[model samples]
Target: MKNVTRRSALGMVVAAGGATFLAACGAQPQATSGNASESASGSASASASVSKSVRSDYSGVAVLEGYTSKPSDYQPATRTEPSKNAPVPVKPAVANENSVEGLYQSIAFFGAAMEYYMRTGKTEPLRESALDNSELKSILEPEKGTLGDGMQQGKIWMQDPSVTITMLSAQPERDGDAYNWDIRLTTDTGEFIASKDRVEEASSDDDRKTEVERTLHGVYENGAWKLTGMRTSSSSSSSASASASDS
Candidate 1:
């Protein structure tokens, strides 16, 4: 019955970012508009393979306000515990000229989706529970078996116990029919849960507190802004830093 908040759950997704759950391809130069399907040969040569790299899903959570014509018409939404197959509700808000507000809401929506996918092993509910567009669809289509298998084999689920965000900003740009954003945020990884469904035993805590900086790439479509790609600027935890040096 414990309620999970966006900031808390966000780190769980960030932690999972490195697992390479998505495709094996690398990032290609995104089209200004139109076809986004990229071949493996198009992957960026300088960094990690796009498919193998863990991109923060935060920047791409769709904010519903972007879909409306009047920015002022948006209303704030209430936070609720996510349910299986149920969509998360986003209260609308106008963003600054740079689209800061929209980015925040989208991050929250992504948090909701991540929590649901972790609990239920499916992203199907995201289509209803949140705003959708072509980019979002493409991202969700490939991970069905992988996500389901993790849930079945590990039975280990994550919940953001506590977390906070500071120094957040989102810069926006236009590309063809879509918009791209560079979002940066820092979070305190609070105590998170790793629970086994079958056991009644009390859960244990894990530390994920880390400083992260990243550029989030997104595309706008279907009246919503959807995440398309991301690159971390830096990700480091104090504890982890010490452990590395000691080794």
Candidate 2:
């Protein structure tokens, strides 16, 4: 099967954030410098609201940057075709609980939850998964301690996607062993698949980076997309910890 790497998956998430931000801004009144000053004062008056906005822990893969105002430079250049050797799609006896969009949205939340854990050294109640029992247990396990001191201080921006993800591949069944499955996604940023290999980089022999890929099966649960598997690359674990330190 065709594999799209991690960088591309992250890029897709960033693109989606960007699009959401733009739509929000477009719906609001444009602010001038004078308005900015006034807004600052008004914001302080509602410090409670501002404090609530400060989310240190997030549920899914944490993207440190917030959504960007400008468009992203990265774009998808290719498309993926299903393998002829692959098994045919199966219609499960149960109806799907999560839409494709809902699945992506839950992924974003999962990212946020990881961030929260790193920041507070506390583990929140993870959303239960319908796909993999073992994977779900791993995600829900309580932490012995904080991942590090606390979250790093910085504003993470998510860039808007140049395209939208129109299709996602069928969910792969979870066996006792871990396997890589590339899911095709179309985004405004470009077309890409969620692949672990795409974001890996080779380092010196003595300091090779390990990559961990978590799988989250989207299940229709609790009226939303619940992640069934949680994969974390060795590279991603380091990056996530580092992001907390840097923030």
Candidate 3:
């Protein structure tokens, strides 16, 4: 199930870092307004913040409060930065148990949690889950830093986005005292499940979803399964109407 060639879909999407940025601030000081007016008289880009980079001192930066008519009527949204108040993603209770089925559920939970953070700009859930210097943290922490930068610059994150993580079927081998699932995971939304009539998809979305099948090295530790490390097995885009794998 391991492939050295592929990186994570989550990483790919986040690394793109093409979040939307607002041109003008909702409010700026009177002194700053004069400078903004001066800049506006010169060039469009000079009077507004366009890039995804933040400055140490915003006062010096000319931010024209967009006023089409009455300045009072055009109240631009006051989203200075990400609200950072997204509710923490709830982890599945079954993930805490040290068992085979529990391991499967735990891996699924991690997939869901990571996607949630990326989609909604929710940091708490990923922060809580990616821990212990395991492989998952290494893969995800860099993405976290990218998101942080976007937030600081007041850039809107994840527009019309789609992401999916498929836990592949593979055999687990023992690693020391802990078991190691040398993670060959991901494929179509639905994968083979000979044991049952159906499998609970880890997650699926219709918003331009990125199809990511990455091999995750899973380990059971402290009574839960954790993603230790990973390599990409495959990466592609999922059709909006693509049906789950029935085979």
Candidate 3 residue pairs in backbone clash: 6-232, 135-228, 162-209, 168-185
* Cα RMSDs, all models: 13.8, 19.1, 22.2
**Residue 122 lDDT, candidate 1, scale 0-100:** 56
Question: How would you encode candidate 3's per-residue C-alpha lDDT over 175-230 as one tens digit per residue?
Answer: 66454543322222111111112212223443223333334455544444565443
Q: How well is each residue in 1-247 modelled by candidate 1, as lDDT tens digits?
A: 1233323333333433311122111100000111112211212222222222122443333333322211332222112222122232332322111133444445444444443344334554345322334434433553333322333343333332211223233334556644554443333222332333221122333333334444445443333345544333245421121100100
Question: Which is better, 2 or 3, measured by TM-score?
Answer: 3
Q: Candidate 3 at residue 212, lDDT?
A: 37
Q: Ranking by TM-score, best first?
A: 3, 1, 2
Q: Measured by TM-score, how close is model 2 to the native structure?
A: 0.29
Q: Candidate 2 residues 1-247, lDDT tens each?
A: 1222334323322222211111110000010111111121223332322112223333333221232212233222222221111111111211121333234433433343332322122333123212344543322332222111111111111111222222122333333432222322222212222112232222232222122344444543333333443333323232321111111
Model 3 misplaced regions, further than 4 Å: 1-88, 130-148, 151-154, 160-162, 170-209, 231-247
Please report the candidate that would top TM-score against the real structure: 3
lDDT of each: 0.32, 0.25, 0.31
Number of clashes found in candidate 1: 7
**Model 1: what TM-score?**
0.39
Model number with the top lDDT: 1
Question: Considering TM-score, which of the candidate structures 1 and 2 is the better prediction for this target?
Answer: 1
